[model samples]
Target: MSTDDPWRPRLAARARLKFDPVAKQELILFPEAALALNETGAAIVRLCEGARSIDQIVDLLSKNYANADRDALMREVMDFLDTIRVRGLLQ
Candidate 1:
């Protein structure tokens, strides 16, 4: 993906994520401490289940939040993905 592509995430096959039942949250745990996700974050986490691409995530968000601006929503989703990935939340 080009640098201008808003939905590009560092693609990797080994990336894994899990939900903590006791905490009622999702966690992305690598070697260091776990990164906890809230409900909205958990929804985004669930969508990246080694299946959908970042563009699909943006489209899904657009469909769900129809009243929101598509570009803005896409940008927000991309930013969130970047934040989570940088925090060791994604593979």
Candidate 2:
């Protein structure tokens, strides 16, 4: 996590994730809402389902998108995560 990047725990931390292998997609359903995720988002959601921190997510993304600059890559990943969170895609 960067100094400028805010980290907020999921509002409903007890929420769980479900993956639909047949659809090659993932869904994060909270008590109030749910979100359907694509492959990349699903990967991130998978990483986040464990106890790994944001830095770990950034590292994973960096290794996956090797051509990207470290800081910029992390920023983009953080931005995507934030967007999903706001859209109720993350628990």
Candidate 3:
């Protein structure tokens, strides 16, 4: 279990999640760059609307994906958040 305080993830002010009808996938559009997201990535980012903490997101996902390992989901959420955060896409 992680002892770190939970983080409430939110999309950066300039970032918005939208579906690209041409590409048929969700994209995180910002000022200078856009990130194409797979279904899983879309789902994860959709929850980062500042209303839930990282732990809360994991709990919800674990409930929805009963077969998924909770620990693995936690790691995945952390990694994805870190990746976006590094790129200034997440707050």
Among the numbered candidates, top lDDT falls to: 3
Model 3 spans > 4 angstroms off? 1-3
Best by TM-score: 3
Number of backbone-clashing residue pairs for each candidate, in the order shown: 0, 0, 0
Cα lDDT for residue 68, candidate 2? 76
For residues 27-50, write the lDDT of model 3, one tens digit per residue: 999998899998878989999999
Residue range 17-46, candidate 1, lDDT tens digits: 678889988776656466787766666776
Cα-based lDDT for every prediction:
0.67, 0.67, 0.89
Ranking by TM-score: 3, 1, 2
Segments in model 1 whose C-alpha atoms lie over 4 Å from true places:
1-15, 49-51, 88-91
Report the Cα RMSD per candidate.
3.4, 3.4, 1.8
Clashing pairs in 3: none
- Which ten-residue region of model 2 has the weakest summed lDDT? 3-12
